[model samples]
Target: MNMPDPVAVFRTEAAELFEQIESGLLDLTHRLNDKDQIDAVFRGLHTLKGSGAMFGFDALAAFTHHCETAFDRVRKGEKPATSELVAAVLAAQDHMRALVDRPTDDHGDIGEVLLARLRCAVEGDAQQPASVQPNPAVVVAEAPKSGSNTWRIRFSLPVNSMVNGTNPLGLLDELRDLGECKVLVNTSAVPSLDVLVPTDLHLSWDVTLTTDQPRSAIDDVFIFVLDDMQLDVETVTEVPVAEPVAAVSAPVPSTVAAPIPPVTMAVQAPVAAAATTERETAVSNADNRQAKAAENVRVPAERLDELMDRVGELVIAQSRLRQLASASMDIQLRSVSEEIERLSGELRDTMMVLRMVPVGSLFGRFRRLVHDLARETGKVIELVTEGETTEVDKTVIERLADPLVHLVRNSIDHGLETPEERRAAGKDEAGKVLLSARQAGGEVIITIKDDGRGINRDRVRAKAESSGLIQPGAVLSDQDLLQLIFAPGFSTAAQVTNLSGRGVGMDVVKKTVEALRGAIDVTSQTGEGSEVSLRIPLTLAIIDGLLVRVGTGRYVIPLSAVEECLELSLEEDLRSRGRSFISLRDSLVPFLRLRDLFRTGTKPDMHQKVVVISTGTERVGMVVDQIIGDHQTVIKSMSKLHHDVATFSGATILGDGSVALILDVAHLVAAGQQQEAQVRAAG
Candidate 1:
């Protein structure tokens, strides 16, 4: 029997709590006076601090305690929630993640630096706020045993309480801290090893306490875990002076340890009532809300990836079975193979859905970035997002994050102008950066558009010519001219800054998008703005592709890119051999002879076909010997030797136990366009 590590479970939960904290903090920056948001932020911090302390994350607890206090002031309306304060906490949350990820690593003075900044942000030219006083209502003091009242308390925690970092032992000890207490453990609920969940809590305790403290003090002992637990407290009777030991039916057994001296804190009167009342109300609602939330099972990300791999393999195996069945004369085998194919497809769909997460998660992280960037550049820039509900593969989202960050940073530091510049340009005081996503066919188009100072075409041309990248007087279209920004080490900025400059970002964005077998497009106008769109496939693992036989080898064209297929007449093929252009719907579309392109040296079949494929606006015809029907292509990575093969994006295993290369539609389209440009230039 393998038991899950308690510490690992706590860390998983801590990560979620941290995300909630960050989200609330980010939301608070927009509505500084929203009390609900402030309370939400405070609750997240308070929970994180308590959970950290419970799990022995002392540094995390200590660092988070200060943040919690900072928010507590805002919650109590002492100091306001300034953008400075929110930014400080946002930066601190990143460090908290590091601490959660690497608890053993020494964080050094990073926490202290953040704390100092937090203090400054909170103070902000005003006198420092008074320190919060501890609650006096929770004070524990011992009076004479004769004057003490005995109470019988019985409690049982939820089975998952221990797994959630709640320790029953700690609760029992706190109860013991109150005067003379005898605890009786009831283990009847615990089962044998075969049926028991090791991490679950099963034992309940019946504690009899004789203390002079008020009822509120007893309530404070179970303050944190009052939710998700069944607790019953009743005063049996006031004990007389003659029979203190006989207050309860059971004597103080040998298991009862000597009570330690109690520690008392002095809390001011004004703080006690509100704090006590708030705790009670919070406890009342916690059980219902948190119990509902606890239903979700948190699975590790690697496990999902592993599951997806298995599903992909199953899909491939099913394809092989279908091929074998198609060749056989037995009807029953074919029928069974068809059913397996359908089931396998459904399973694959389910796996894909599991991997598809909303783009909102990707979009959410940018709020903090925009906030910090606005402050860093001393610009009033607003971030607007749309189509956040669109979903994409998780792997794509993760890989796209860094490139998107680079693009947004470039937009803020270079594309968007300073406040003074905007005023001079007769534009609104605040510039707008729009981040939007939408699904087109099988791809998701994520665009970063900014309404600020547009690209300086002359500066770009000058930079390219000065760097010897292009001809001095080359004529280029608007789109082509804008694309020069993605050339290696290309930049039009006059000087370097901490955020950008010295020529970076855009070229890397181009490379990253292409590495994912995706295409990027740039559109810009003087004084209006610019939009850089990244069109990436929804999933990189598997796709429905049109398998075509070119020469003696077979290749796949993404079904999403294939429009239609037409037979190439022998006469037309021979007459237009040098031209390599075919008439389609009264338009001349460029065609590529895969036989010549691959240099296979094999004769074309008698009935050759031209498959019309496209990437965005460009269309190209791929000549193949025969067209194989749609195939479920489980994409396999190209070998290191073939990594530089621009024509083939990846390889897939055919149903006939043979391998087929996946054609790179974007690259093929580019090649066709380049050929057309050359042909036109010669003509």
Candidate 2:
């Protein structure tokens, strides 16, 4: 097994820390008096600085320290939290991220500019009137006493803390910075060499400090690691102090066995009483933390992809085994095959669940984007999100990010009205953009809706004609007219802007969504809003499909889309031959004869089956010769040469080593709907 690089781990953790800090700062915009958010932002910056220094990111540490100090002022009531301060820090946070990503690159000029802005914000906040300032008495940290007192502070960090980018020496140096201090190393917990892990720390520390600083100052030293470490701080007073111990540069192995010097009864009495109760509580808390940590293990994403590929291969191999067993007369071979088949299916299901992640993470990233865009465009845009907890395949979410960005930018730039324009239009000054996700069968529908000026059908048609994308005054449905916006080099905007109107993004959005085996649906109502929805499969690796033979060619119909199957006798098939419509119970559903559609050039069997499939509310039936049992399908993408073949989405290998195409349900349903419309027009 290969261990992960410590630097890589630090980078991942630093990314998360950046998110936490950015989120807190953005939330602070809504409530500048939120003390909890201030503290949270301060802690994130403090940890990022310490961890950056630990991982040799000196530039990041140096830059972040200034932001930390600025927040510290707000935290201590020296300067109130203001919008200017939050915006300045948010800008500085971006610089800090650059430092982390490229520590050796020259960022001196940028750093200086950001620091000046931060200083200006802080100085400006300090000039606020007393009536608007925070309550100094209630919010301030306790001031240090005039007289000095000795403190006995002992602490032991979690064994894996050092492995997690924590520097023990940094903590010790901070303690020394407080005042005169003598540290004693405790290594009695070290195990023998044969059984020891090199990365684990087994030592603790005991320190005696003489300082006038309040206890809060001491607590600040361990604030980042306090949740997982054991710390005991108590005052020892009125006793004659021991001889001033010389500062030691390093610890020797001999010190491992050396015992701590005994203290007098005067100091020991109070320490004994406090140690009993506090130690018990610390132990219980530590145990709980350890248990919670053990519950979840963070594995790199590439590893999960690798595991999924292996599972896919296992599924293919099991399919081959099942075919072999079916033909064999040996009872034992068939029994073994059946058992392995069941276990492989169970493993596949579990692997799929592991790859599923909530859409909330993807949605959370848009908050900062919306904030920045609002500031840029001078638009009062309120972004509302729903169904963030809906789960989708990680691959789907990753690929959907860019397409969603394009849709949202277009909505804000073109669809939404400016604040003043909204007011003039008898609408609220703040325009609304809503993003929502929900699961429908095996697909997750993601919708981006904006309340503003809807898509102008006349403008879209005029643009289409002017761009030569359509003939003059061509007849088209409302949906077809709206979809023309996705044509190459199509733009209805009169002028170009930074966010959109370059005629680049919407077409790319269409192509990318289609590449993911997804479909896009657009709807607009004049003067109300426009909604664009993307329906994407829950997973791409494997699927349960109903296999059937159209003449001699076999195809896989996604089982999730199969509503029901009906048998068609020769007489019924002959009667519906011209119309291709099936009356089931009362309503008529359009049916397509696959043998004719594919032009297989093979005669159909006497007993045919109509496999009913649907995409949303529209249903279509495909007539086939035989209905094979359900198969576990591992989808393989079509080659570029055949990618434009709209009838088939992809291909999969069968049990007998032959290839079968996976039907594109959305395309066929649309085709069926068009057929139904044409027949009605003819009538």
Best by TM-score: 2
List residue ranges in candidate 1 displaced over 4 A. 127-164, 168-224, 230-295
C-alpha root-mean-square deviation, each candidate: 7.9, 6.8
C-alpha-based local distance difference test score of model 1: 0.82
565-661 per-residue lDDT for model 2 (tens digits):
9999889989987688998789999999998999989887999999999877779998999999799999998999997898889999997889999
Pairs of residues at least 3 apart in sequence or in different chains that clash in candidate 2: none
Best by lDDT: 2
Model 2: CA > 4 A from native: 125-165, 172-214, 226-289
Instruction: Itemize residue pairs with steric clashes in candidate 1.
Output: none
